[model samples]
Target: MHQQSAGQLPAEVLAAFQDEQQQLDAAGIPAGVATVGSVMPDGDLLDAHGEPTTLTAARNGRPAVVVFYRGAWCPYCNIALRAYQEQLQPALATRGVALVAISPQTPDGSLTMQQTKELTFTVLSDAGNQIARRLGILTAPTEPVRQAQAALGLDLTTVNADHTPALPMPAVALVDTAGVLRWIDVHPNYATRTEPAAVLAALTTLD
Candidate 1:
């Protein structure tokens, strides 16, 4: 799917994304960020039903695999979510782990995406990116990338719940029942995602 996008995208737009990737490389990961063995951060988020919740609630006393995505407006995010549902969710279920997807979109948007994608797992809205910020994975689009997205008719401010135009790097983190992170995958490239096979492998180690 990403190959198809790269092939169809205009040179200017592709260049803009490349420039943003370079900038992100220069910025480096945030300092003092949570790593393996650290407890997952807590935040008040909204479920697809618009009810207040937390990651732990989504886990429901089970281990969890949390996915951080950009938003419903992103094609890449849609593809990733669907793939996870079709390929990963069953494996996670066998392990007694819940799969939860998080985004900065509002609860309404989350509901729309969950229904449109026919997802069976939990989908939550991380308003203001409270949890992502605490995890040190939030990133604001570069000016060039933002301009390119605007040109493509995607206004981040309108899609994001916080209206900050920021997104979390697409990430997959495995949290134990105790809320300690056991494994994590943070992808700097928005065009890519953590593969389901890799997530399954991570889950095996937890058992």
Candidate 2:
């Protein structure tokens, strides 16, 4: 196993998910790689409409930004998405960087979101939490959320359009043209996330 260090995340995130299982217990917040390394078996995911869009297709020989969010139901997720749509996209494009927002939301849901948020970049769906699971960041929801989701008909599997019934990490990863990770921002609290200005700063490292 790699000797994971705190530098993969900020001090706050490090405190949240030091051990793998501790991250699983944290509600709202999803834990991911607090330490960075080359991705494994990276591949495509179904878009909001259920079309497969691969990671290789998305992050080709160009600097790219990938943002992962819970479904659109989360208010904080909405804030982060809108912030990227309205502010982060333009700022990053200026630096020749591409931005993509990924979620397990269904294609119809993603379309509605695109219209609602006026997002201009690619929005891929990791239905079944396939992408998250492959990345080793998918988490099972706490019982309370499972019950609430069932009551509200917010089944993530349906939202994802697949069999994956788990939650995913709330984070953003920056990769340069060569598909190398330069920075990753993760939050343990679902109510919070990395800000747009900080995301832009990360893009600067690609320069």
Candidate 3:
């Protein structure tokens, strides 16, 4: 996926991105990450309009496929989200499941991502990645990668709601109406994501 834009990036920036991917692959999923049967944590979030909301509110008593992505500035995130909107959303709707995508980006950024992707599902802003932290899916770019991102005109400080470089490892969690996590897939490597098919298959296991 990075190859698509590699030609456009400086050599050093591309190398930095590769190094980050290697480190993530070696580290694997973080220890103590939320597992199936655990209660999914609810946290304060901002809707695309910047209105206060919560994970439970967005779920509205329905089973939900909760997505945690880096932000609108991430090309891989955009691709994954667009795929979810097109493929996963309709399938989830048929099963009475809600699809919600959360990011640490500001409300405006969330709004832009939804608008740009023409997404119909709920998009929320986790001001400080409160839910992500509790789920143990938190990650941040390495220093070299951060510098590379800056070279590409991406600034996490201004792009993120918390004004920090923190981000969630791209993840998908299936939560039943009871707030129990049915399944979870975490990708420490930012370039990879939970495929729509994988998420739908997991939904079949939910009671």
Residue 31 in candidate 2 has what lDDT?
A: 41
Q: Which ten residues in a row have the lowest lDDT in candidate 1?
A: 108-117
Better of 1 and 3 by lDDT: 3
- By summed lDDT, which 10 consecutive residues of candidate 2 come out lowest? 1-10
Q: Candidate 2: TM-score? A: 0.76
| lDDT, candidate 3, 80-136, per-residue tens | 988998899999999999999999999887655346559899999999999999999
Model 2 C-alpha lDDT per residue in residues 1-207, reported as the tens digit of each score: 113434443454334333443544354333445345465225558654567777657765667888878777655677678778888888777777888777777767754645455777777776666656666566656555555556655676666556566666787888777777788876655556788888877766766
Best by TM-score: 3
Between prediction 2 and prediction 3, the one with superior TM-score is 3
Q: After superposing candidate 3, which stretches have Cα over 4 Å from the reference?
A: 111-117
What lDDT is reached at residue 52 by model 3? Answer: 98
Tell me the TM-score of each prediction against the true structure. Answer: 0.91, 0.76, 0.97
Estimate candidate 1's alpha-carbon lDDT, on a 0 to 1 scale.
0.86
Ranking by TM-score: 3, 1, 2
Model 1 C-alpha lDDT per residue in residues 18-99, reported as the tens digit of each score: 7887776676666655799999997999998889999988888899999999888887888898899999998888878999
